[model samples]
Target: MRLPVRIALLLILFFCADLCFSYVQKELRPQTALQERDIPNALHPLVKQNAELLQTAALKKGITVVITEGFRSIEEQNELYRQGRSKKGNIVTYAKGGESYHNYGLAIDFALQKKDGSLIWDMTYDGNQNGRPDWLEVVSIAKTLGFDWGGDWRNFKDYPHLQMIPG
Candidate 1:
């Protein structure tokens, strides 16, 4: 084959491989069962459904949950990592893109709020005895809705985080 023609063919093959690589990276995870649909603001379906149900249940106990964060993009995660890598600001959260379930749209961070919308985030998970029990009932509601609460993580209980197992 002529050198020029061979080079052109090789360039085409390289471009196709690059495109395929990008696609794979974008879809590395299995299909998002509940994330791709059902959420009010682009939430994963299962996550949103269960979250709403849990929110409803919490209402019965006079607890209101405010979804503080949800569905972070890789770029957002990267930015967050930079901001949180330090111990300052009480270390709000610790997650990096592809490391956090949020990348798959299966996670959300929530906080209990009062009638006036003041955050009531329980600080007891970190041994702060002054925290309130407002979010405990929210946990019960989430369990009934089939969500795995990050609050139950043994090593690091995230009192304000809720997650999905995704059937």
Candidate 2:
């Protein structure tokens, strides 16, 4: 083979290998589950605004809150719905695919994080030593910010869930 042609072929192979590696790396990147990236920017403007307010107000009251679930993809929602139904663990949700506000970027689920970086979903937990439950304090602040706490629902009590009402 000619030296120039051989060099060109080697460069082409290197480029193809680089592209393949990039694709695989993206596919293998771990999905964000209970983190800030789970919250999509497509959420209703009010929901996003109130979520910020809830976080800030909770912080003022010595409670640390983090949004764990938001703007769920249809596949993610189906997997959650399958839990405790066709899959193992407790039934987390009754909504499927397009059924929940999360599918429309209108809802969020929260958890309290301790100073040690441990996340807690216990509604009655008061890790701040303030005598009041951190979960309730978070929810109270959320309500004031115009978010409806799922804990107030009669049928299913999702202590961490909050959604904004459409005007």
Clashes of each: 5, 0
- Count of clashes in candidate 1: 5
In terms of lDDT, the best-performing candidate is 2
TM-score of 2: 0.72
**Per-residue lDDT of 31-90 in model 2, one digit per residue for the tens?**
222223333547777888888888888888888889888787878889989999999998
lDDT of all predictions: 0.69, 0.80
The deviation in Å at residue 21 for candidate 2 is 61
The prediction achieving the highest TM-score against the true structure is: 2
User: How does model 1 fare in lDDT?
Assistant: 0.69
Candidate 1 global TM-score: 0.64
- Tens-digit lDDT track for model 1 on 101-120? 67667888888776666776
